[model samples]
Target: MTRFSGFRVLKEALTGHNGWAPLWRNPAPKPAYDFVIIGGGGHGLATAYTLAKTFGQANVAVLEKGWIGGGNVGRNTTIIRSNYLLPGNQPFYELSMKLWENLEQDTNFNSMVSQRGIINLIHSDAQRDAYRRRGNAMMLSGAGARLLDVDQLRQMVPFLNYDNARFPIRGALMQSRAGTARHDGVAWGYARGADSRGVDIIQNCEVTGFRVEGGKVQGVETTRGFIGAGKVGVAVAGHSSQVMAKAGLRLPIESHALQAFVSEGLKPTIPGVITFGAGHFYVSQSDKGGLVFGGDIDGYNSYAQRGNLPVVEDVAEGGMALMPMIGRARLLRSWGGIVDMSMDGSPIIDRTPIDGLYFNGGWNYGGFKATPAAGHVFAHLLATDTPHETATAFRFDRFNRGYVIDEKGVGATPNLH
Candidate 1:
């Protein structure tokens, strides 16, 4: 079947020499900067903005291969929740939630962050126990989370099928403030705001290599030219490994493809994001009334955005089970985005072995929600040269120390947290 992709339209929108807006009207002049950030995704752009905002470092430039937000920011399902199942991640994600709460007002950008709520459907007794512990842990950490039974799930979404489904809803762990945002709004807002602050947002400038001198990262060799910087940050998410290896650093992250699909605009069948614990299936209704959903990771190491058919089938089947009414609904869009799955499932926001180089990769799929907080925390690390207390556990050394923050306690799905 042919696909109806919002992503395809986006790729076309960012084309024609002058990528993204304002890139053509007035371009930036090439010069050495105080800080040069690679990858203009939500994380990278936000990091640069935070750096300048907090430290008054306006001599910063954000380099992008495509236009800003052309990467995962354009492709994410936009689920923002702190319903983490582990201690290491719950607190940090809670911090992210607070940041998300104030981001729109602060940035003067309509990120479209809706905190309506998110529900994780528990299909089995084991899933119930796991969610119970997760909900309790979240509350203890001062984040709101509640466990709802099958009856409660039905009450919340009356359309949900409680019986005769592949994964029956036994219960759910619900966080009232967990929700979504307009993915592109995040990147554009940050880009426009950062540019206004005298930060050079060099689009279509891909970093092909890194320049290191005396064991310190000096700058980046990009497609445009060699951009100099006192400190270089590799904020590249999906291409984190590829970008770092150019600087002779190896991160314990593997790239994988994650895809999301949207059904033709419906009557907003889903109030907020809903995830089935038994499978990696989740769905949410966009403001446009499209039923946006995604399944689990493609389950292999690959940079390919095209996914295997099994996942697509599984997601569709799960959607039908959740709301049988959508069984015949038209599938409007299908697209994939690559993710940098760190070993621990948590982000590695720390100073790598290389000096003057900061790494903010390995976000898994939490890039959208964590953008504001990622910026705040990463700036804290960059400006003060101290790992923010909240993001301390997400250090890069945790993998070697065996201190993995495996939130689902699943060694395999490091991206779940």
Candidate 2:
């Protein structure tokens, strides 16, 4: 691994920039390992990185069906924040925020973590109070938050439709430390970090079935081969059901397609991440001047990574309602990623009924933001066989115990979540 720094950049520039090495290796999987992570996306790669770097687990491998960064890890809008109102979600996300803050230094890779800020606009008085409460919850969790009045919001984002006849923007819940990171860079960084610590990152290696004997997972059958492992961790988002079914375990998760859009490059418009108070639309300006945005999931169960027109039109309406000026901007391209919408909208990171199998999925729309903490906590569980303190509420048996962490209060309906 080549260490990247200003001196290296200068040296490379002087030497025709040919001294750079690949960020991560394309390693072949071993026949057996201490641990195997079934996915190569951000969460899986981060899990491998944490297991090797943090937990001192050297015999680890990350098996990805496709290439790295080909999943939701690179498909998200790249917003990172911790402004939840639920006890189960607030602290976990706050931990992720702190991890994001120092991720570049920790990984020795430039993930392009920009802590610009994020503002969730408040529309009605009730919404204002709700945002205030949410902001208070964020503060209580040691995540920064502030309540900004309409005037303050106007000063920050004057392009918004402040006084619309329907759904007026009264205020906003602001998180100063919240922002975005480069999606693909995050995956590459984690992959590199994990590989440097002797974790094999095997791409194009699909897990076909679980090798369970006597009710405990011995390993997994993959396209590459039947790789043996002491423990197997499943972090395949959206495909949780299909993957778990191979092991005779069913999850309380539904797959839904969530679309994200990027507009034609424009001037520096969106100051930071901003969400409409009345709708699910959220927009942020990328470093390359493109306005990246997204909205609610497609409101239907789907395994496809493409969405329908109704969602596009609905998201456009939300965007226009928030900032009418963007109506003139042309949409450059759009894509969708399948999300594992859990019954209660919160993620699950817990040990399964099977002895050597662990589960981590049902992230809904929060997967990208929760990558670091999810990986750390999931790795903690895998290495120590105990749940992280902040993630104690994300139990697999919570639904059966009638203790669902319904963060959005949308009840048991996965589509609504």
Candidate 3:
């Protein structure tokens, strides 16, 4: 089970603001680009930036229907860690964490990247065994991680419930290198860097359909007009399936709501990212003294960002469990975003059946933290037309081949993992 980070309650006490806001400016289009990236979220922006930085400028475009950073880029709880339980995903995520190490220097965007330590709590013997295996895998991969028993857990999280009602702590998987970062800064930094490199950032341009030729995708047809591309790539998380269907393709992913909330501002109480594996809960505190967090998704498909009440109640209940002092904290606000639930918990980053087309999606809840890593690996794929060995298992046909990398072995609810 995941442990509650105990930061959400502190966010409610904040008076003046929600965390990140959107910045949208209408601009004219350039004649052409080397690559056209659809979806202006963190991954899309990062992809464009990486392409320009590596492949050189004058051929990249990021098209967004709404605005950059307004999608899941800003909507996620912003947890950045590589506590995955598999081989392919674990190393890939560790690489992403390495990029995040110098993102501020790379993009000159003060992302406020924090490495205040993150812990995954275990509630059952089964979970302890899983943590043991995962920890050993990390050690084998040369990543630093440890499995802490109940005694060590108490030292790490003194406020936690040692003896509990619903569940009790047995042990925890701790990765000292894991943490969170500012989401908007990450997007804006990449945007500014990519823009300086002459990449076009197009907002309010919705791709209505794809323009294909002899089984090759030539360009895209948008609400504004027809624009041609040498190749087309879709990185839209929430609307990935919708965009792919325009070309007669339907991914195994379904859009679902993942809601998050903040408490009124309190003193910087909660320190780092926390997850309650046994329950639907997680929390973290931002530098601004606001606790930022959410729990498991709503478990239903919906485009609406407004979530139901039960999730909020569940989150608050979990928060109170970890930090009883937060019982009186006022819930300031809550919002949700559409998550692209992949068939397996892992992401899908590979070539599809459509020629001259590609994908950088199936993120589920892994978007914000994996931004730089996604951009780098995806750019490598785009430029070389080859899968980064780390992402080879995340191909589209894995589902059909029965080569599923089900990290949590989450059966039907792909988003829950």
Candidate 4:
């Protein structure tokens, strides 16, 4: 792999910029590998990178059904934060935030990590108390937080409708370190890093079935042919249930479509990521001058990457309720990504019933923010055969064991989560 530097850029510039090579190799799958990751998205590529770079795994392969960066890794609204009140989620996400801080240097690829901060608006006294508790939890986990009153919030984001007729803004929970990253850049960087470490990234190769014998996973059957592996890790996001079903496993997950939108280019107005307390609306300004925003997932089970009209209207209503000024901005485009909503609204990363077969899914709305740590912990688990300390609570049997990490206290309802 070529080491990228300012000198390299200058040299390439002098030579008409023709000496640059591909970021990663598109390799064909080998007959066997020591480890096989079943998805090529951010989490899968990050897992492969960590396995090779940190765990010293030499023989590894990442098999993707389509081209890389063509999934949720690129479809998300790009917000990254660790402002959780739950023990199972806060520390893990903080680890990811730390990783995001160093990702560009570590991978030698620019991921455009912008820590412009995020504010969760508070609408009433009860909401203020809840945000205070959540802020305290964030502080305890070494993540920064601040409680800002209505005056302070108004100074920071004066465009918001503070004196709305229905839900007036009272305060906010601010996290100075929480922000967003370039989604596709994240996927490409991890893929390049993993490929440089001799990890085979085989695209256009779909896993058709698991090659299990006598309750132990031997490998997987793919469209390219049978590729053997000592252990198999499944991280295929929203398609978790369908992929696992090929191995006779039923996961406690449902697939739902989460829609995101971008508005026409405008002058920089939004200072940072901001979310409404009374609704699911969140908005931020992209580097390209577009207003990037999104809200709740479509309330229906869907394998398709498109949402219905009801969710579109609901999201627009939420935005209008928060910032009436946005009513004038024209929407540029909108799209959806299938999310794997777990029963308890948290993620699951654990060993399955089949020996040597690991599972990582049930991310709900937290997948993008959790990518780096998810990769690190999942790699640690696959490398050492033990769960990482921060990820110990994300177990497969937690549901049946009655130890659900109901982060939102929404019970087992997938849509509500």
Candidate 5:
């Protein structure tokens, strides 16, 4: 594999850029492997890379139905943050935040991780109190947060509708290390690193069924063939239920389509990520000067990868409510990704009743932000039969044991979170 560096760039530039090699290999699946990962998205690829690099498990294969980055890994708004108020979530996400801080150098690829910071705008006194509590929680978790008063917030983002009588802006909970990254770059970096470490990345090879015998997973039946495996891990995002159903195990998750939008390119207006406290809207300016933003998911069970118009309207209303100037920007395009909404709004990274089968899903709206930690912890679970230290609370039996990590405190309702 070719190492990318400033010297390499200068050399390639001098040589007409013809010395560059492919990022990853498109090799055919082998007859069997020590481990098989069933998703090529960020979480799965990161898991594979960690298994190979950290755990020394190089005899691995990642099977994807479509090409890498075609799933939620690419179809996202690219926001990354660790602003949470829950005990189980705060530490894990903070770990992800730290990983994002060094991801580019660690992977030997530029992921465009810009820690420009993020703010959750408060609209009222009650909301201000709530955000203060959240900020305290974030600080306790070592994520580092601050409370910005109205004047400070106004100076930071002067274009917001601060005097709106309906949802008046009061303050904000800001995290200086939270920001965005190139979604595609993350997937490619992980894939390239995993492939460089001898992990076979089998694209267009979908897992059709689990090859189980006597309550143990033996391998997988894929579109290509029955690829034998000593252990199998699944990280499919929204299609978790359907995929796990093939193994006779039901998951406590529902699939919902979450839409994200990008507006036409213009002069950089939004400095960093800003979220509405009164509504679900959040916006950030991309390097291309396009306003990238999104809101709540389509409030219904769905396996489709596209969302309906009601959500589009709701997101637009949220952006307009937060910054009235957003109304002037025309929506350039929109896309959706199937989100696996777990019962408690927290993720699950645990082994199943079926032996040799491990599952990682139910990220809800926090998938992209949690990619690195989710992968590292999940790889820790797969490499060693124990949960990662920071991810001890994300277990499948949590709900039944009354230990649900509900960040929103919304009980077991998936959509409410």
Candidate 6:
């Protein structure tokens, strides 16, 4: 592959733009590979890239049922932050934020990562106190946080409904380095990087069943053919349970559809991402001038990629409450992506009971932001057969051991999380 550079781009532009080539090669899957990863989303592709580049494991294959970035990787609001509170999650997510800071340089692709900052609005005295504690936790974790007063918030975002009759915006918890990134660009960059490292990314190859024998997995039965593998890792997002069921493993996870919406193009209004603490709504202005936002999940188990209208109404209500001016902006489009809501509102990345089979799922709507670190740690576990330092708490046995990392304090409620 030719290295992409500004000079090359200028040369191609002057030469009638005919010097460009495909970012990645289209290669067929071999009969066997050293490692086989199911799913072609951001995490899976990142895992493949890390496995090859960091661990020196190039004989890998990533099997995607659909095209790359067709899943949650592309179907998110494109927010990235690590303002977590729990030790189990804070360090892991902080690592992801660090990786995100250097993602474009590492992948040699412009992911459009914008550290424009984010704010979680506080609506009441109690909420302000909670946010203060959360901000302290974030700062302690080295993820940078600040508790902004009402006057400070006014100076930052004067357009918010500060004087609402109810749920009035009092203040906010600010993460100056938290921001957003281009979702599709991230997936494409990782896929290209992995492909360049000789990892076969096979699209339209769905895994039908796992080839297991005597408590060990040998390979997988797929739509194309039976592909043998020395090790197998599962990273299917919302379909985690269904995919793992084929391997006879049940997970403490629920599949729910999370809806996201975009507004028609407008002038740059939102300076950065903002979340309504009184509600589940979060919004950010995209590079194209459209307002990208989303709210709570559909509140039910579903494998569908589309969402219902009630969520649309609920999200609209929250957005209107946060910034009434958005009501006048015409709604352009909306879509849904299935999320693997873990029982304890956290993710799980560990080896299954079956030897040679690993699992990485239950991201609970945080999948996109956690892509790079998820891939790096999962690759570390897969390559070394041990948990990574930052990810030791994301083990599969945590739920059984009552070590749940309930960041939202929602007890065993996937929908609430």
For model 5, where is the 10-residue window of minimal lDDT?
Answer: 271-280
Candidate-wise lDDT, in order: 0.81, 0.92, 0.81, 0.93, 0.93, 0.93
Q: Encode model 3's per-residue lDDT on 133-188: one tens digit a residue.
A: 98888776666787889898787677777688777878788888889888888998
lDDT of 4 by residue, 13-86 (tens): 99999998999888878989999999999999999999999999979999999998898898999999999999
Writing each residue's lDDT as its tens digit, candidate 2 over 286-320 gives: 99898999888999899999999998999999999
Quote model 2's TM-score.
0.99
Clashing pairs in 6: none
Q: Give stretches of model 2 more than 4 Å off.
A: none
| Predicted candidate 5 versus true structure: per-residue lDDT over 31-72, tens digit per residue | 999999999999999999999999999999999999988999
Taking every candidate in turn, the Cα RMSD to the unseen true structure, in Å, is: 6.5, 0.8, 7.1, 0.8, 0.9, 0.8
lDDT of 6 by residue, 1-417 (tens): 677778989999899999888888878889999999999999999999999999999999999998988999989999999998899999999999999999999998999999999999988888888888888888888998989989998888889998878888888899999999999999999999999999999999999999999888999999999999999999998999999999988999999999999999999989999998567799999999999999999999998889999989988998988899998999899999999999989999999999999999999989999999999999999999999999999998998799999989989889999
- The reply for model 6, stretches above 4 Å from the true place, is none
Model 5 local distance difference test score? 0.93
Model 4 bad stretches (over 4 Å): none
TM per prediction: 0.91, 0.99, 0.91, 0.99, 0.99, 0.99
| Shift of residue 76 alpha carbon in model 5, Å | 1.0
lDDT winner, 1 or 5: 5
